[model samples]
Target: MKDKIQSFFHLEEHGTNIQTEIIAGITTFVTIAYILVVNPSILGDGGMDPGAVFTATAVTAAFGTCLMALSTNYPFILAPGMGLNAFMIYTVVLSMGYTWEVALAAFFVEGLIFLVIALTNIREVVLDAIPLSLKFAITAGIGLFITLIGLKNAGIVVDSPSTLITIFPFHSSMQDGSFATGGISALLGLVGIVITALLMIHNVKGNILLGILITWALGLVCQLAGVYVPDPAAGYGSLIPDFSRGLSVPSMALTFMKMDFSQVFSVGFATVVIAYLFTNISETFGALVGSASKAGVLQEDGKFPRFKNALVAQSVGVLTAAVTGTSATTSVVECAAGIAAGGKTGLTSLVTGIMFLISLLLSPIFLAIPSFATAPALVIVGFLMISSLLAIDFSDMSEAMPAFICLFTIPFTYSIVEGMALGFISYVVINTLGGTERRKKVSVAMYVIALLFVAKYFFV
Candidate 1:
């Protein structure tokens, strides 16, 4: 059974090993759960009803991932997306006040563009032409930015209307010396217990995810029972998503077409394309490597296009959203949590897809998980994200300063792209002025991306 399942996941990296496959699969799901939630929350930034959008998220996640599984034997999961969601909502929608339909129309168009990129081999050209180190930095840097946003949203960081930014407060409602404080403290204690047990107690393989799951389960149980555990405010309810009646793409499509398409093209194809393409590259690459490693589908040369197919299918997902009446991008990492629970191969994804298809009957199930429960998960993810900074070439102040600036700017500015833009821009300036001979083939790509960031933020 173990060998068969191992073969099914295709976890042969440089070489195949079942034990490694198990570890990779579990870790990938753990990471993916957070990634899934990443896009949804960012998409929620626009003025859409979180409830309705969550429903859309469920549907798109189901359909898109199923298509990927069917189209490819690889295990990369698909869903609404992350960077694009933020680009659309916080940047495009919030900045311009565009209609959801228009924003989605832009998304659909971008998806088509993505398909063009994927089908025409531009995808591999870009990925191959890009330097692995820069890509690594971008991925990790994005991770840091993501963590900061999560922390900021959770009130781990508070903004000062005057001086710019500040940390947690000394006293307030959430800060009161009440049962709430005690409860969170207790929860922290439990988390400590989890860390301790994983590190010190048991010899279990996936202890990290297990700790997170136990916390999630406990948090959910308390919230559902209305048990006012630590944070009463951190409650998650089974709010239903009313998508009854078979499927109604016509109505959804009409609503979608009415959205703004002007900003998409007018915003300069270069900038949008980079954000869209690079976002797809980084996000899908992460998912593919993760799912492939977990699924054991790696070829001898590490060729795994399951991610490409999954991502390519996402262009269709964007179209589906336009017709499905939702503002989401792709599957939430919590979906991966379900995968982590004994899911193997495309079968795990198919089951998840089915569950998503039948989500209307279980919108409550989706709503049952609260942010506070996921808070620790996000916090842990943030830590993981920030840790990637360790790879930055810190020996030189030029490389170190810009990377550090980008790292810090995320939580302070409350934006990932902004941080990335600033980081890339800063990297260019520093490298140019400092005359660092050490670089890669992708530096030009970095410069191209950096220029786009400048235009998007300043000019646009």
Candidate 2:
């Protein structure tokens, strides 16, 4: 009976035992944990403290995810996500100059919008209305962005003269004063991915998880050895970027809210939200499928999920994140890693939850985990994501164009929402005016999707 349940999500086949699942879970946790530190850094520059924001994200991740794990039979985790956080900082703070409080207000407002749309089942309609190619393109675009982030963080690429970025920065040596001996992110990310790929080719068990662990350890060693990484300046305290700033309920809610949300749309809020929705959906899909696959609990057809139940848990998660004082509606990618790690029940999430709850008391300890250490994992993960591009149907314009647009726009534009919006609009326009297609009855709803896309581009 237990095996059957696990198999329902396709977990037993992949995730295997408790030990393997735990490792995967931890790896996933490590991959995204830096947000606790980095988010505060990004948001704090706008006047929020470094420590408080990080703590808020960490606490929400631990507590919100625990709620998710406890509430559902499915395996998933909750955390403030890449796109949303970036949106809040870049589009909201930098582009709009909103305080953390005003930002938090917008976040909560967005959560409300999300809840309404999701409950209305508009999620399915919009997803369906989005051209499949566009989805692929958006997915690919995010993959490129993730890859670029990894590469940049690894010091593989640096500020160049001609282009926005360059493959090599220093003439003969790295920025940190080392020759070939440094550049651990590049070395580990490239080498680790190759090794993992080979192991995968050989059908080795837990190759992905193994490769991540090995690279993580190696990166840490390099950090300690005074390799290519630069030491902090005279008064540098927390090196990895802290989440403590701007995370208090009052700070995030009041500070972020002071900014006019009217400006959110002006600063590409629509674009940001649209892109964020795509990434969030992607993470959720992957986590759901991967967990089920690893546990051997996935349905055979791979159709619908436990939508209503899952949404209930997810809704609570978004709300909790705002209350805790951070970004909104960030569904974690690591939850799938946990599900893969023999997390038969929510016990695995429970463990992670307790760890997070405990972290509030020991925020300083978490602050010490260097982001450079995690950069390798992200780069490797980006490599893994690129594999999805092959799944796109090149022959179908409806599919191919959207896919290509989404793939190209995200990294190039440094904006996920822009890519998604373009893809969505392109899909509708192309299908409606392709002239080569058989005439069929078009729905008023389809036209609505198209018009909204136009609004996103010109009106907003």
Candidate 3:
């Protein structure tokens, strides 16, 4: 049985063993498990039922990761991405005043488009057209964006009327003995970060997961002792999650195949679909390349072997997520944690997928973990991502300028699509102005994409 399993995954060929792959799988699952809580909460805020969203998030993640393992044999996992979910709920549903049904239709349409692109050579062309510097910048930009999200969740940063944003009053609140005004949560976040960092520094396996659990336990103790006070502004009203029932069966009634396609051809709808498509493509590309590079699986020509299979799996995952009533699922950068832990085959993804399925029965316990406890992991992951910036060639202004714009604009504009558009446009214009050789380097597709982005920004 063991030999057959090894031969199936070609574990020996990849210089990995079953034990290491299993540990890597667990590590990957731990790093990304927070999505089981976070995605549901975010989607529920947009008028979907929390229970339904919870079930959908888990099912989609498991289905997507399993497809990745089986089809691509790559140790990558998929989930409803953090930014894409926010875009679905905040931008598409709330701000646009469209019903959740309409937003879901857009997601479904976007997924189909992605599938079409993935099956054609267009996907490969797009991936290859992107400059290496810009790719690194996008990865780093996502890191900063994730870290910023963590800071906001922990209440370490707060809205300011005069300055736009300011630090929370941790010191003043401590002096005045006011625990609710961001002091306690800020302190707790600090403790979580310190503990997680220390564990990671010591090479402890599953440090991210362990840190979150330990911090959650501490929060529970504080709640029981009457010291942990929740603040409404920070998106927490209680440290404890409402237990709907000890165990509940997964439900797909609210969101399954509920898309409303009547408004699909409208300009507003088109813009939403385009945004989702662009974001998913760029984000998945960055994640796959970055994680593969970390795993030492990227080929000498800077291409990923079996890249087409990975793309197809992710596209299928996105399609599944839409039908499951969630946002588009994409490859996650956190899969790098598993690779760093020595995962080299699909077995690792298989284990992670099984864990996600198991989480369906443990939603209540996982949801009980307060947002602040998970904030530390995001911040740490962001720091790890920014390390890629060291590889960029700062001396080349043409490359550096575009990379810098891509890196800073993501966090500044708070939209991944916008950052990528600006970066692509700047890269083409700057390189064209440099010389004939540089102009030749910019592909026609890049020019077309830049123009489309410009049109979207102004007209759409």
Candidate 4:
């Protein structure tokens, strides 16, 4: 069995053993498992059953991850994207007054469009057309973006009206001897970051995975000692796994096969579909670029191997998501956590996919992993990704400026596609105007993409 597994996944060629791959997979799974709980809660506001959304979300994620493994043999994880879900619920359903069913139909049509595009050379060409500097910028940008995500999740950072962002109020809250909910969690997050950093400095194996478990264990101990109080109202709930609800999988009856295509030809629906397509394609491209770069899998031309296969898997995953009654599915940024842990081949993704399947019965245990625990891992991974910036040729402002824009916009705007759009636009405009020689270097694909982005911003 071991030999067959190694042969199929090319584990030896990838310089990863089964044990390492499994550990990487588990780390990725735990890091991203929060989506199971969060997705349902977000979608439920549109009057969809939260329980059904949970099941559908898990199912779509498993399908996408496994398909990615089988097709590309790269350790990329997929799920219902956070931003896409919010767009569907808030912008499409609630704000636009469209029923949740109509929104699903829009996503369904987007999936069909994705399927057609994946069958062609367009997607791969666009990915290859991205300048090498911008590719590195995307990596660093995503790194900073996810790092900010870690900070927000751990409560280490909070919104500020005065400055736009501020550190958690540890000083003032501690003086009163009654720590605020966010303050305590933020404090724990800082400690976790230190502990994880120490583990890394010591060259400890599985340092990230260990950091998460240790942080969660400490939170549990603090709860016992009453230093960390659970404030359910503030989104800080009990650390203990609640098995009172039983382990039976939630039924998907409420949302299964619920798509309504009645508004498919309407103008508003076309806008919705275009928005989904733009975001989905751009986000998938950005994620693939970052993950492949981190895994050392990108070819010299800045394209990854088996590119079409990966897109096919992503498109199929989106179709599965729409059919299962959820939002569009795409490659997630959390796969970097596994690559940081030494995952190189598809086996890692296979393990993550299996875990998502297992979570069907063990939801309580997986869902109980607090965001603060995973925050440390994400923070560390973010640093590793940002190191790509050191490779850029900052001496050339033409390249450096666009790279800088992409790197800054990703974290600040909190959208990978958004960052990529502005970066591409800036890259094309700058390089085209640099000189006649530089204009000759810009590919037709780059020009076309820049025009599309401009049109998207202006018309759409």
User: lDDT tens string, model 2, 1-460?
Assistant: 7565355434455445555545655645644555554455445545666566766777778876777666664556677765566556554465544555656655655566666666777766645554445545655566677667656555566677678787643446555654434344556656765776686678555455455556556655665675645445511223332456533222334332233456454534554444455555555555555655664555778654565555556666666666666776555655654554456555566566666665566565445544443354455556666677887888876668766776787677765665666666666667667665611323465566556657766665
Each model's TM-score, in the order given?
0.70, 0.73, 0.86, 0.73
Once model 1 is optimally superposed onto the true structure by TM-score, how far is the C-alpha of residue 51 displaced, in angstroms?
2.2
Look at candidate 4 and give me any clashing residue pairs.
none
- Report lDDT (Cα) of residue 212, candidate 4: 74
Q: CA lDDT, every prediction?
A: 0.54, 0.57, 0.82, 0.82
lDDT of 4 by residue, 1-460 (tens): 9999999999989888999999999989877876775576558667898768878999999999999998999999999986677668756786667899998998889998888889986765655666778878877887787678778878889889998888887888788754746777888888989999999899665577678778888888888888889998877888887888899887888888899999887766776786577667767887887899999999898867888888899999998998998889989878988999999999999999999899899766545667788678768868977887998999988889999998898677765555767887899999899999778768997787677667656654
Tens-place lDDT digits, model 1, residues 1-460: 8666546545353243544434434444444443333334455546655556666666677787677656664344566654456556654466445556566666666667767776776777667644443445555655655544544544455468986656555355355654343344335334534462554245444443455456556654554565444444543233222346434321223333454566666654345445555656665666566656655556778886455676667667666765555543443333344344434455455544665555445444333344433445445554554555666667867667776766666445545456566777877777776654744322676777777777776666
**Least accurate stretch of 10 residues (summed lDDT) in model 3?**
230-239
The list of candidate 4 runs beyond 4 A from truth reads 1-54, 68-114, 175-180, 201-207, 251-307, 322-352, 415-418, 456-460
**In terms of TM-score, which candidate is strongest?**
3
Worst 10 residues of 1 by lDDT: 248-257
- In model 3, pairs of residues that clash are none
RMSD of 2: 6.1
Worst window of 10 by summed lDDT in candidate 2: 233-242
After superposition, candidate 2 runs with Cα above 4 Å error: 1-50, 87-106, 120-123, 172-271, 293-306, 436-450, 456-460
Worst 10 residues of 4 by lDDT: 451-460
